[model samples]
Target: MAKSEVIDVRVSRRVLWVGAEAYPLHNIARATTIRIEPDRMAAVGRFLKSLLILAILTVAAVAVIGRVDWPSGSGQDALRGVVVFAVVMVAVFAAQLLKVLMTRTYYALVIETSGTPRAVLVSTDAREVGGLVLGIMDAISNPHAEFRTQIINYNSTHIGDKINQIGGIGNVGKRVGS
Candidate 1:
């Protein structure tokens, strides 16, 4: 890790018996989870849409110009082109649908293709996660930034109380996202 590289390390609260996995904050390259597939899909869709529109416009212009012999089987060629284009559009739609169905949202310590730990935690509240990650990373890298005593809760009641402390009382009894 470069000294100038900013990395945030978040601890994930896993299952009860498994314990929290945030500290010994080494090899933590990021605090936030990365999402890539949706953007990729959008880009591909944009490209295909533009290509489709261009093809249609080109065909329309050719028909209007009528420079080619219209009576000598060019109409059959145009029909063939239209049929092929429609099939391609349907194929693209089916491929996109299959990709959507196959893709699953994962929350894990992913290794980038370049072989690096991508993040320290997943599905974190960005507001709290960043500060905590920075704090811990700083403490580890610079001894003077050591963390002071802080409450660590192990039960639902204590966790709820802490959440209430942060003015999340309304979310106390509900499951996440409820």
Candidate 2:
């Protein structure tokens, strides 16, 4: 139960954890190389719109083909129209495939902190190639070791202070030179 029993360890750029404890902290970094051009979602919207228009056009084309008199004439023209429709369908599928490929280029990084019984902290970060970096410091033991709650409370306080330091938010763990 003493504070010294608990420790926080950072395994890599994506994972952080409290040692000798059950809980873990998770952090994820996203791939940033793939750039999203202006109105990136616009492409997706346009693709969807094209699909809708194509669907309506296809229904109309089918209706027209069904109504035409095949035995008398015009069968050739109808067949040509169907071929064109097939080509359009293929184009739509290709566009969708491209969108998916572009979207997948982005990556994610996750960090998790855990110990003996359970997880303590979990966090996720998404950024471009120059993503945010996190650092972990060694854990300090609590003098009140008998109570688990006291140990957790002390560790939590220290962890918060460490996080603030890592984030450049405030000074932490400073001792007076009295």
Candidate 3:
């Protein structure tokens, strides 16, 4: 299957924004927005660390209790068990702790149509997320327009008749005629 057919966009040193060949850029019917969320696997390392710690603690407890040899004085004692368990746990903890560090964020590019968002492009690089979102918006707004600046126009004035309303529907014409 074609890469562009399945994925809405691709990124590297630069982002390659593409849509379905049938609809292309002009088929982008409505506005879109970008939302940043923690990746689903962002806490996977945390889960692994929790499991590792739990295992180590359980094993240490077992070793502490199991070291007491009833008859044989030559058996490994509790002191050795405690020391060995501590060293192993500490070493594993540091290694697993690096994996648990939260460093990835998910950027979701929501493509809307007739007010409902249908397509979403997710990315790990949050730095380019905003730019990609703007690029998509700019593409939708003016397909031929170049991505000149990151200056987003937040103030899109959409006025409605409700602005002049005094209270409710009862005061709609009352405020105007008076």
Candidate 4:
């Protein structure tokens, strides 16, 4: 297994360094932490919905086959095809469930600058990120405050698009009767 990169973070009165990316303290509008949790229930709900649709389709197919009188061989072949399709669908759902179940919770150091808000550092360790946030806050308040820390296993939470998509669903951002 590859060892995680020991990221360098430095906070002074002027600049904040996360890895090699530096943000001047004056340009940093806000600095905070966000928890990224996988929506496991949503994943399970989707799986159940898919399963219901498959069941409904299977029932409809069986009902149609029963009502329509065809050659004996043709009816059997159609039933076999339905079974194969159902099996494939089940396999796909199982894989999706496994991925959801295996996902872990992550903490992110979100910094909002003049450009766009970005997650400068992400890790599974919450305390480390929290400490970093405190350090940044201290630096902003006290000019002489400074600190350095190392972070290993920098995992990404893929939250860049998610933050921008908030309140974008339904009629939140749309004008009615436009």
Candidate 5:
């Protein structure tokens, strides 16, 4: 992802300005922070399935080779080929598992307007997003309140909407087993 621009945020005279998008404070019914941890179970499951298939194929190949008669020197050559293929498959599986393990967690400042809730700012840094949430809450009640902060718009979904969309956390897509 590209670097995020330093967004301008100000809440004054009942208006909340996030970058160039201005929202009236009254329109914002609620504001809160959510910690979004990447769901990796699906990726892990795929890796496991691939490994299982590879294991079965390797066993089948060995069994067939042992039972079959080949040209004087060809049997050993075929076994070597199987060994090389298995090694490459294992390496690919390991790389996939590593990628899933390295996925980052995200923190977001979500604001619920009269319509659906939206993620206005997202960061990998929890403190930055948490502080922004508090500032927004303060601005909601205090018209004179103002806040300024920089946020990195990391790749993130609207967590509030996701909770509702997936029928709340731990129920479905976010976890391994419903």
Candidate 6:
């Protein structure tokens, strides 16, 4: 006896030909590539966290010292208060400086990637930075990812043709919309 085989046929929604083989467009042949390295941002986050912890510890120590009374005529109590105030001021300054540094770094990274296929690379990096800083260090790193995504999506939709006209990695044939 012989057995019969059944076959199924269906129309694909979209198709793409990379080389000689055709692939369904909806089926991702490759995962979305990430050009930005998360480790760099993670390292920055760790540094900020350590700085914050040190600041908190220093302030606590100063508070403990301020509470104790020393010899009245020695002027040690007044010196202790001044030292505490100075340490608190330094901590506040360090926090502010770190914040500014992170902000500048985020913007620099964003601007550097503009007009490239990895333009969204900046957005992803910024997103990670913002998430880590806001989540871990209580800092406002960069709240621009959503806006950046919107802009990138819009450009990829509308001005994509113009971008392709210029001819680069972001060109039509190489990119999603082209």
**For each predicted model, how many residue pairs clash, with residues at least 3 apart or on different chains?**
0, 36, 0, 0, 0, 1
TM-score of each: 0.33, 0.31, 0.42, 0.74, 0.78, 0.23
Q: What C-alpha lDDT does candidate 5 achieve relative to the native structure?
A: 0.80
Ranking by TM-score: 5, 4, 3, 1, 2, 6
Per residue, candidate 6 scores C-alpha lDDT tens digits across 155-175 of 121243453355357543545
Mind giving the per-residue lDDT tens digits that candidate 2 earns over 21-111?
A: 3222222222112222334466667677777777787778878888777975577778688879768786876677576546422222222
- The weakest ten consecutive residues by lDDT in model 1 span 149-158
Winner by lDDT between candidate 6 and candidate 2: 2
lDDT of each: 0.46, 0.41, 0.50, 0.82, 0.80, 0.38
lDDT of 4 by residue, 128-161 (tens): 8898888887788778888887887465434333
Residues 1-178, model 5: lDDT tens digits: 2346567777767788877778898898898889877568888888899999999999999899988999998999999999999999999998988887797877877889999888787778898878877888888878788877666676433335343453455644446344
Arranged by lDDT, best first: 4, 5, 3, 1, 2, 6
User: After superposing candidate 3, which stretches have Cα over 4 Å from the reference?
Assistant: 1-16, 19-23, 29-69, 72-78, 112-127, 146-178
Query: Which numbered prediction scores highest in TM-score against the true structure?
Result: 5
Candidate 2 runs further than 4 Å off = 1-38, 72-80, 96-178
Pull out the clashing pairs in model 6: 172-178
lDDT of 4: 0.82
Candidate 3 residue lDDT tens string, 106-147: 455555555556434445545555676677566666645544
Model 1: runs farther than 4 Å from truth?
A: 1-37, 40-48, 51-55, 61-67, 97-102, 110-178
Q: Which stretches of candidate 6 lie over 4 Å from their true place?
A: 1-71, 104-178
